[model samples]
Target: MSNPKPLRKAVLPVAGLGTRFLPATKAMPKEMLPVVDRPLIQYAIDEAREAGIEEFCLITGRGKDSLIDYFDIAYELEDTLRERHKLDCLKALEPSFIEAGSLIAVRQQEPLGLGHAIWCARAFIGDDPFAILLPDDIVQAASGKGCLKQLADAYHETGGSVVAVTEVPREQTNRYGILDVGKDDGRLVEVKGLVEKPKPEDAPSNLSIIGRYVLTPEVMPYLSKLEKGAGGEVQLTDAMAKTIGEVPFHGLRYEGTRYDCGNKLGFLEAQVAFALERPDLADGVKTFLKKYIDKV
Candidate 1:
């Protein structure tokens, strides 16, 4: 068989209504929420860029113009910053802007599901194996290489679809797509099967998939059927499950901390954790956190 094509592009599904964040998300996309100094979406894009992804396809929905605008050059803002000699401010915006023609935005137009959102990007993805990063799932790698980069390195070695997974408790198996094991090393598991949100008793293993995935383009046809599975929506997990044995699939246990910014508590925790990582803010945040904990 021909060698696997080099992974170049990535798809980010940012079309969710952000209902979990409620009023804060009323006028803004949840992915735009600030995590310390950067928006949640920016972190995902940075991770993809770190993985050598050159083009980005953002699957957007209504009222997501802010997300598109965020990656665009702010001519007026730059002018003001330059005029005031605010070099630092201008430098901060550099990474947020994508190349002139590398970014593509496709509209989802409905709240179908993750599978549907990904399927919308089929035209842009063409035939390349692509990476997918959920903005809400911010994964911080202790090794300095971003989570997607870690997965990309694994993909190059395995030459098939690779997904980032973590071992969740057995009782929590119902909350995620659990993997069935075929063979295992300490860091990677050969995926024999995948079940979407299976019951604790039915779960093949507690190795649950996170938001990071490097998928083969062959899965697009399965998603195109729009078949609603668990939770009565087009589940991406369902589509991935069909690819077993057809390709080499493996689950990567990345060394990272994942913050689920989709939920209230998780969002708060991420804010504090990310803040504590910043040198300028670390001391103050830690002091406040300790006092608050003692009072409670």
Candidate 2:
């Protein structure tokens, strides 16, 4: 068997209209919404960088130019910081910098779905195995590696395709793409089948596919078919399901907390959870919570 191609590129589908966030997202891309301090897209980029991804392609839609502009250098801002001798502030901006030509932004002409959004980056993806990270789902690893980094490690070992999976309530299976398990070895579960939003009775397992995925190039042709599934949108899970028998596919039970920033409640919970994790804000946040609880 030949060696697996290294994962060097990551695709971020940031084209959603974010109807859930409404007025706040009216003028800004939902990917630009701040989780604690950093934007959701920034957190996704940071996770991808942890996995040693070299290039990034952002699949965007109308009114999402701000997502691309975030990576570009702001000369005036840098000059002001330099003049003020704010060295620490300058250092903090390092993550926002992308080497020229390494980042590409491609537009998704319509709101087809996740699969179509990813398919928009075919030219940029070329023949390499690429990772797809959805910015709406922000995952924070409990200890060592980020969610994507863990998936990347698994992909390096098993090759083909690897996706981050987390157990959800069986009743909620219809809300996500449920996985059919072949083998379970604690951390990685061999993907025997994939069901896009199956009913609770039909779900094979509670392991629901999240936003992080490390996929092989072989899956692209399946996506190109544009077969609408589940929500009448070209689902990425449907295309990925086609690759099950052909390639080595597995779902990783990553060690982390996932916050679905796509919705209001999950977004609010993420802000508090992330704030509590930071040493600088933990005590203050805790104190405020306690005081607020006493008042209530």
Candidate 3:
């Protein structure tokens, strides 16, 4: 078989209203919410860059212009920083830079579903295998390779679509897309089928897909049909299920800690966890946490 085309592009679906964030998201897009000093969307872009993604297609909605503007060169701000000789501030902005035309943002037009959001970028993806990463699912890989890179590596060997997955509690199967396991080699499992948000008793296995996906262009035709599945939204899982036998599909068990920043508690937990990982703030944060524990 011919070698699979190198994955060059990534799609990020950022059209959600972020209802869980309430007043904070009333005006600001949730993707702009900072996990520390950097916004959440920046982390996702950083991950894609690490995986060798050269082009980015962001599925945006109304009031998400800020997401597009974040990657643009800030001429006024740079001029001010240069005049003030604030080299440190200028250096911090380096990571946000994207190649002149590498970034593209497409409007989703409605609050449909993840499937529809992905479909909106079909033109941007063209005929190449592409990746999809949800900004809300922030994954920190223990190997420092990022979750997308892990799936990309597996895709190279398997020559088909690969999705990052982790074992969730049996009772929590309904919260995610559960996979029907075929062959398991500990790290990679052959995907026989997929069930979107299946009841615990009906779930095929405990392993559930996360946000990182390396999908072939073949799935686009299925998504184009706009068939609504669970929750009355066009479901990506349902579309993917139709391609099970047509192409080689597998679930990769990535080594990482995933934070669901879409929820309030999870967002707070990620903030504290990320802060503790930084050498500059680890000691101070640990001391404050101890004091709070004593007070409580």
Give each model's whole-structure lDDT.
0.93, 0.92, 0.94
Error of 3 at 127 (Å): 0.8
Better model by lDDT: candidate 1 vs candidate 3: 3
Candidate 3 residue lDDT tens string, 1-296 = 25999999999999999999989999999999999788999999999999999999999989999898999999999999999999999999999999989999999998789999999999998899999999999997788789999998999999999999999999999999999999999999999999999999999999999999999998999999999999999999999999999899999999889999999988988899899889999999999999999999
- For model 3 the TM-score comes to 0.98
Q: Which ten residues in a row have the lowest lDDT in candidate 2?
A: 1-10
**Candidate 1 backbone collisions, by pair:** none
Taking the tens digit of each residue's C-alpha lDDT, what string does model 1 give over 1-296? 24778889999999998999989999999999999889999999999999999999999988999999999999999999999999999999998999988999999988888999999999998889999999989997798888999999899888899999999999999999899998898898999899999999999999999999999998999999999999998999999989887889999999889989989999999999889889999999989999999999
Q: What is the Cα-based lDDT of residue 6 in candidate 1? A: 88
RMSD of each: 1.1, 1.0, 0.9
lDDT of 2 at 191: 95
Candidate 1: stretches off by over 4 Å:
none
Alpha-carbon RMSD, candidate 2: 1.0
Per-residue error (Å), model 3, residue 243: 0.6
| Top TM-score hit | 3
After superposition, the stretches of candidate 3 with alpha carbons farther than 4 Å from their true spots are none
Clashing pairs in 2: none
